[model samples]
Target: MEGRAFTHTRRALWETRTTFETAPYGSIAAAYFAMWLGLRGIKLSAVILHDLATALGAKAVARATQYFLQSLRPEVGSQPVHGWDSLIFLIIYSVIVFLPLWWLADLRWARGAVYRYRATTRTTKALHFCAEAYSRPPGKRTSQLRDLESGLRAAENAILRAHRYAGTFPRRSPRSAAVRAHAALVAGALRAESLKIDADPNATLPRLGAMLAVIGERCAEGRIGAMLSEEFLAEATPVSLTRTAIRESVHVIVVVTAAMVAAVGGSSALRALGVNDDLRPWLIAGCSVVAAIVVGGWHRVGRLLELMPGK
Candidate 1:
């Protein structure tokens, strides 16, 4: 058992080392480092541009050597290509290209991810409906009173469920906050309507109705995802945002320019000193990781300028 365990561990280590040696580890490490720095508000644009330029160059080189790039020439395939061959082709094409692009661009895939982690679609719809209901919503006053009543009832049920599962949420959980807010709003609206009815038995209620409509509009159009609402977590860029961007842009330019020069000059110098091909890629990768860490950590010091507040 001990011998088998030792052999398995050694084999795993050897495989890992071999993969690193053959793969584009230098470019990968540099790319990740660039992303970390960018996210931390280091001159993000410059770092990104550098990575983009590198990718373009790499792609150009790759094209010369590789064949069968996801699909054939469009002009060559004028005839309708159908059956099992087309199905297999589409599966391979999607796996190689479409899936990565979808994830990177955060298309419909993000919505699924949002639902999986936070509140369900049913809960979100209930919150929105309740918010709109409380405001009475324009063109939907007494005409949709039944819908308003049903929405509020659904929201109340959702809030009760949320409270019951309070342990499932995070400290600053948006879904929980939204649920609580809607529950309070429902109670408040009911109380306000009751008081208005008691004070004036035959009140026309034009002002009260208008106010609710406006509030409902805000709630309906204010959110990006289930939890990120304008009222809850503001997405508007701050006044100081321009200044912060300029500073970071300058940082990126300086860092990226220096990195390019060093990479070119140092590589040639190291080659002259007889650095073997086997060791050179690892050295480059190490440098890329170090560069990313330093810039990322530098901005993480002192006060983190809230580039996008509450993001």
Candidate 2:
């Protein structure tokens, strides 16, 4: 729809610099608005709402967490400088300190959010429409029903082929391959159900319609079920868990090392900024503990890693 467009929220360096420094609110507002508008149609609103809720929940947790962390730090240098000067420092400090923690929390929730979003997009509206056609009077729907039935068989064969090929990826990308296998199984079941329908003499629309409705419902559910396939979960679980564990351990180590070093240098650093550091121990411990907690929430953080591309 355009020759040159900037759909991405982040672009040029100057724009990013200005946005982050002067009004991060603009960035936040743009992101929120874009999410709503981008997903306004095509039936993904539920996914968006879920993500919003997850983010809100993460924010609430991050707020409490940051408050507790602040309490653990020295109050000596925290006295206000007053006016906009103080605000600038506070903004910088908040970005430097709390944002990363909140971002990690958000990343945790974004995993489920992405999976739900992708699953929601794979709808069965076309199948429902075909169901309606199949429900019509026999004389009127013969040709359409025949074509639809043939199409279903073709789709089933294609999906079965895909399922067979999935084994090749079981060791490489088991999660996605498992989804295909699950979807293929469900599709196969639906095909068998359709094949079971009696085309007896003078069969009524009521019987045909019921079977079609069943097919339609199954069509809708199969895709979502694939997204949550047990086999896929089973095959992918160990890999994801291992990666998540290693990542979390590294994060904890980094946090502990960084905090301890910072606490050591904190006195000089604070003095340079005309402040003091009396709660070095508290700061070091709090930072280490908070970082560990952020990584240790396996259910939240682990799934987030699983959702990542090429994970």
Candidate 3:
């Protein structure tokens, strides 16, 4: 009896399932997130490297200028060079660290949507094939059950391909709803057809044929494609464009700010500690690690909040 109950439950789930198949979103996100965090580390390292290189370069330039000045005027040799000369260099290094990393993050973020579109294309293709396959004569369809089921499975696979990624995005959308509805329609009809075949291996299911006819009519209407197209195009609207621009600008600002703070602040903190010049480079490296931790932790905290139950 227990076995029978389990079988019935399984059958019910198979027949009624409407949600997109689950993908490895959590695993993929975790992996990609590690890489994202590594980019922060790289940014920190860039700042450290920039400071060291500029220190050495500035020293050489200062020595050359000092010698040239002393040769021209013996008393001018003792004049001090402004320490803030490297400020502009630090800003330049910040831009160097910002652009490529920012581009990579944007690419990773956009990848989720790219996969979604691919999944939609595959599912739509499968749906169209199923509709065509169902249009066959009843006798021919008996020999085509395997093919029809294969098509349905393909559609399910396609939707699942990006399911996990889609979950990270906002829930409500016309395109997603339409796709879910179409999948449910197809899944229900196919499950019913299979049950009929199981009950009578050789008989044609008039009920299933009528259901398939309706499904074909629905597919013919092309409502799913229309809805998806509408939603996709809506992303290009002025408001959406402005929102995207603002979000991108925020990312750039955050990254550049972190880089500058880590570089300049690290040097100042070392100076305040009265560390000897020989230890300053080593201390700066240590400070970079600390800065990476603080900045990366802050970013990850925001991400965790975003992934929380609501907003």
The candidate that achieves the highest lDDT relative to the unseen native structure: 3
User: Comparing 2 and 3 by lDDT, which wins?
Assistant: 3
Using TM-score as the yardstick, the better of models 1 and 3 is: 1
- Candidate ordering by lDDT (highest first): 3, 2, 1
Cα lDDT tens digits for candidate 1, 95-210: 44434333332232222222221222233343344444446644455534444444433433332233322244555777655555543443344334434522542342433333
**Each candidate structure's count of clashing pairs:** 2, 0, 0
Model 1: colliding residue pairs? 43-252, 135-212
Model 2: lDDT to the true structure: 0.41
Best by TM-score: 1
lDDT string for model 2 (155-242, tens) is 4433333323223234455566555555555454545445444454134333333433333333223332342234323423122323
Residue 307 CA displacement from its true place in model 1, Å: 16
Tell me the whole-model lDDT of each prediction, alpha carbons only: 0.39, 0.41, 0.45
Cα deviation at 104, candidate 2, in Å, is 33
- In the order shown, the candidates' Cα RMSDs to the true structure are 24.8, 22.5, 20.3
Q: How do all models score by TM-score?
A: 0.28, 0.25, 0.24
